[model samples]
Target: MKNNILFKQQLFLVLTAIFFTSCLSNVDEEVIIEEPVSEITFNVHVKPIIDNNCTQCHSTAGGTSPNLETYAGVSANAARIKAEVESKRMPIGGTLTDEEIQAISIWVDAGSLNN
Candidate 1:
């Protein structure tokens, strides 16, 4: 009876260890890597930033600031935009991420293409 109890205890310990270890084993982990935007387009990339940050004050109708309402308007002011955003000057009420500033710089450097 003692031998049987010892065997059962050893089996229980081994089974518990196996169960816990199996539970702790690594399942497949999904790591998503986002590739940086190599080509930034005005309509796709710049428009959102301008719409979110500038349009409230600089829309075509308000006219207090330059109209950032269209591609022509934004392209014309791309250099200024880059400068202001780089210096954290333009968003007046808020701020942009470094990545956002870098994207604008990259877009401006790439000729502020309308793509």
Candidate 2:
């Protein structure tokens, strides 16, 4: 009788471990489906981020700034823009969404085209 109880307990523990392992195996990993970098453009995508976020202090109107309000200005400093945004250093008093930062990064990676 004692051996039977011990055997049942060990069986229960083994079954419980198997059940939990199966449950863990069924859990799906989260996959983010962001827009392709090729789909990101300067005029439509990057401009909006720079206009709404960066222009606050990186424009001609902002004084002593890099003039991030225009295509030439943004393209000229595309690498720096990506670096600053990735580091969360720009936009000064405000914040940018992950989507916005990804857009800027994609634009720069796509060669900072005028489009």
Candidate 3:
């Protein structure tokens, strides 16, 4: 019957509206996805790089350049350190990997945090 078909179409429209409304209502307002920032600490990240590559010649005992035994010492020459490392000038006959240099650069840029 025509009436039966009309009723079925109306019911289908109502169901679709209800379905869409429910779906829209279920959406969250603010979805904050906090991405963890990998912090570059002096003792944890920067110290290891200096110890591995720079301390051999930049230490207090038999070092040729400035002392890098402490955070203060390293921070004092942070600019020079960045320049030399970037240019591959220091470490004498050795070399620092791109990752290592980047870590150092990041540390310096982050105010050379002692952590």
Candidate 4:
């Protein structure tokens, strides 16, 4: 009788442990995942800066020749834009702080999402 009780107790303990572990594993799997940072919309965030600063000289009718008004335009010229931004050559004659430059660079590096 005692042996039977011990065996049952052990079995119950093992089952309880398994139940708790399975619950924990499910909880872990339920954790919400975040979207990739690169997927963020550049049109909404980064374009405003370009519009305010570079567009005057770089737009369709501006001195810079090409217009960065649309995604195709911007993506096509991403390399040049990246070079100028990386070299701090853009926003010519105007000053943008390091933080602003970093933001622009990050947006570009993030695949320039159109949103």
Number of the predicted model whose lDDT against the real structure is largest: 2
What would the TM-scores of all predictions be? 0.65, 0.71, 0.64, 0.59
> Global lDDT of each model?
0.84, 0.87, 0.83, 0.73
Q: How far in Å is the alpha carbon of 49 misplaced in model 1? A: 0.5
Error of 2 at 33 (Å): 2.1
User: Which residue runs does candidate 1 get wrong by more than 4 Å?
Assistant: 1-38
**Candidate 2, position 40, lDDT:** 94
The collision pairs in model 1 are none
Residue-wise C-alpha lDDT for candidate 1, range 6-61, written one tens digit per residue? 99999999999999998878567766443355667777778898899898888857
Alpha carbon deviation, residue 10, candidate 1 (Å): 72
For 1-49, candidate 2 gives per-residue lDDT tens digits of 9999999999999999999999999999988667987789898888988
Question: What is the Cα root-mean-square deviation between model 3 and the actual structure?
Answer: 10.5
Model 1 misses residue 114 by how many Å? 0.6
Any runs in candidate 2 off by more than 4 Å, and if so which? Answer: 1-30
Q: Is candidate 1 or candidate 3 better by lDDT?
A: 1
Candidate 4: Cα lDDT at 8: 100
> Ranking under TM-score, best-scoring first?
2, 1, 3, 4
